[model samples]
Target: MARSLKNPKKRKNKGSKKGGGASSSSIPSLPTKVWQPGVDKLEEGEELQCDPSAYNSLHAFHIGWPCLSFDILHDQLGLIRTGFPQTVYCIAGTQAEKAPWNYIGVFKLSKISGKRRDLVPKRHDDDGDGDDDMDSESSSDDEEEGGEGESQPPVLQLHKVAHEGGVNRIRAMAQNPHICASWADTGRVQIWDLSADLNALAESEADVSTGGSTLLSRAPLIKFGGHKDEGYALDWSPLVSGRLLSGDCKNCIYLWEPSSSATWNVDPSPFIGHTASVEDLQWSPTEPDVFASCSVDWTIAIWDARRGKSPAAVIKAHKADVNVISWNRLASCMIASGSDDGTFSIHDLRQLQGDSRVAHFEYHKLPITSIEWSPHEPSTLAVSSADNQLTIWDLSLEKDEEEEAEFKAQIKEKVDVPEDLPPQLLFVHQGQKDLKELHWHGQIPGMLMSTAADGFNILMPSNIENTLPSENS
Candidate 1:
């Protein structure tokens, strides 16, 4: 996927050739500081909850620890189909004695119906506490939730494993979903083998870990010692089975190659570019040997795994620190980035004009934290911000030919534009606290999952699927 810079070959991607959409670049942008959308248009009887059968819905929590890092297994091919139900594992934390106490938890959302006797250990068995206590807890939860039917709260079967220092990030391996790598604030990267624990639960055995108070830390299967500072980013390669990538607070990136040694051996030298901390790293869905990284240095760099010393291409991407970057899941030449300056942008790698942007979105109120293209509909993406807002926007809208031509002429002449808006604004969600992460379910295109300060939310679009972009703009 690393293009020979001289020729700069362009992949015939329909989306890239079509450019952005008909409307402007950024969606309805905010010129003001505060985000207070008026909700008076809502009908009185309308409910935010989706039907039980529908994957689109909203699930939130009022109190608990904040989930900083989590991974949702998007079974694209459903090849991961197993007797075990789909689950979400998150790294969360609460105030502890000396510092923040972090724990990794597994939550089985009841909507993923399956035999659970084997998937969850009976709480009653663990404590030998009477059924009366369980009844009381259920009653209290029911009273607080106070809903029925489509609004009926999901049944959560949770198992947790406590860890020292806060867990900054977690990634579930595509090769084996049960194996996860977690980066901790203690400057340690740990691999937790949930095999015996999760499998026993699926067999109706009392396996209570990864979602419990117990310190179920397994043996040191793998830990990359190169990251001496905060390790906030970790991603397992989807194309290369167990090949893993991690970035640390010390502005270094480390690639782990398993075959080099029986013990996990990482490339001795850090990927020595990015002057600032590497914020995020994502692999090209189509390019197995190539990946991209965003950094606080206000740039996005593409690197070839075979040549680990430097990036193949570096784009001066933003005016501020880039917080996150996502390579379009379905398109080889397209990518998106979020920044600390309350902005996120889309780029077509084929058009390499210096500092020229295809679509620069400066609409959100706070710095964008995470952004991901919908797996089912790559044209749409869900963005979560530090201001506790979640928005889904469609990027495939087309521009009028005449108007687009005039705009191009202005850009060709180096004319400046004051503002940018999105082509199609699909949905905006608020009323949550500390929104940090969001991702769409692989099978259900309209469904979204988000992690917040106090809890997690499963967002379902009421009744809208993405529309494909027209070939011509």
Candidate 2:
């Protein structure tokens, strides 16, 4: 054995394993531990552990902001790339302890991928060359010395900046289908170039008497005058690029356009109609020549841009103050208006004859603060209220048909469930006691975002991954 131990590499033992280890047939196997679903594993007094992956699938949270009122701008291009891309631009008021409200900041919704990062330009370095470099440097210096020359100034780029004073409200318009403009209480209306600079907003610096240089600038394309009260609502003409309409607290509305003269004047044309403070104004998305305005006088007036003395039609359907008006994106002849009386009505412009309401929706316990039609699905509508709730409705689905046999049959066949099964309810988080605004994502039909007295919340359809399914399948 001693002799063989020295020469072990040259000889193999008879009891050796096949793979130079313990044989697979001789090895003993340990019992496998199978995990059963729904089993709770916890220590005494410890809280139950939820499935992290499952929780990650659900995106819901409150992004807090003070002073309550805020506005949401939906990203149209982002929605087309991602399945329900939840990108939204929010403008909120800022308050520091007892300090007066002064600062306003814009925030883009941070998605699951990561937080948004701004890309700023970096200075370029130049090395000494031959005659070409000398000529270039000489030309640049000459342009600087002359204060203006063939050399162009640095192109201005917008940056999202928080103001010292908070923003009270925001109004937005889509310049094209993709670009948008937002106006805040800072006496500033910012045009956001949505193509590449969604995160950047430019404010005109023409009003500044003295100031340091800034990466962003704002030029008041139009100036509105009339009401001493804060501007309530603003609407852009879907037909014209430079034309804008605004409403104020003095029961007056004005039409503003860029001056045609060499010395650009910012004066606006006055379009007067409402007797009480105007609450909201909306341009017909389909009819560029027609527009509508609502007021506390409990009336919604339809106006023609060609002539404005009195409204073409006065919708005196609401018993109380009309708070909001929205033109349907799908149907040009249909419109919706909400009132302080806790009710909303659908108006058919084609059938505006003797005492006829196309449809009426009454669900909110408090006054309806705002209303909007779904851009993706025309038959659906959303309304926000002071009662701290955002409700979604399907106009195609009749409430009276809930008990109908045909309706029950259709639901059972579609869901493959019993007829007694309750309808699925979609509830949005209100967070605080009152909700200020609710906006639907322009590109993603079923997704909506809302801002309330407490914070902001986003609601997405239950199954977004299956948004577009194979037709045959």
Q: What range of 10 consecutive residues in model 1 has the weakest lDDT sum? A: 11-20
TM-score of candidate 2 against the unseen true structure: 0.62
Q: Write the per-residue lDDT of candidate 1 for residues 1-473, one digit (tens) a residue.
A: 00011110121111111111111212234221222323123345532321221223455541124556677653333422322223433333322232334466654454332211111112565665443442233332222122332244445545556666666677887777777788877788877666664554344433232233354544647766668787566788888777788898787888886673234678778886889888898987877878888888999988997876799888888889888888887875788999988789998877755653578777786788889987766678888787656778878866466876664553442222323335455666665555677776655445667765545666555434434232211
Segments of candidate 1 deviating more than 4 angstroms: 1-55, 61-64, 74-100, 112-148, 201-215, 260-263, 353-356, 398-423, 466-473
Error of 1 at 255 (Å): 0.6
Q: Rate the local accuracy (lDDT) of all candidates.
A: 0.59, 0.50
- Stretch of 10 with least lDDT, candidate 2: 15-24
lDDT of candidate 2 over 317-340, digit per residue (tens): 698888888888787777888889
> What's the C-alpha lDDT at position 367 in model 1?
82
Off by over 4 Å in 2: 1-64, 67-86, 90-101, 113-168, 176-225, 259-269, 399-430, 463-473
Model 1 TM-score (2 dp) = 0.70
**All candidates' TM-scores?**
0.70, 0.62
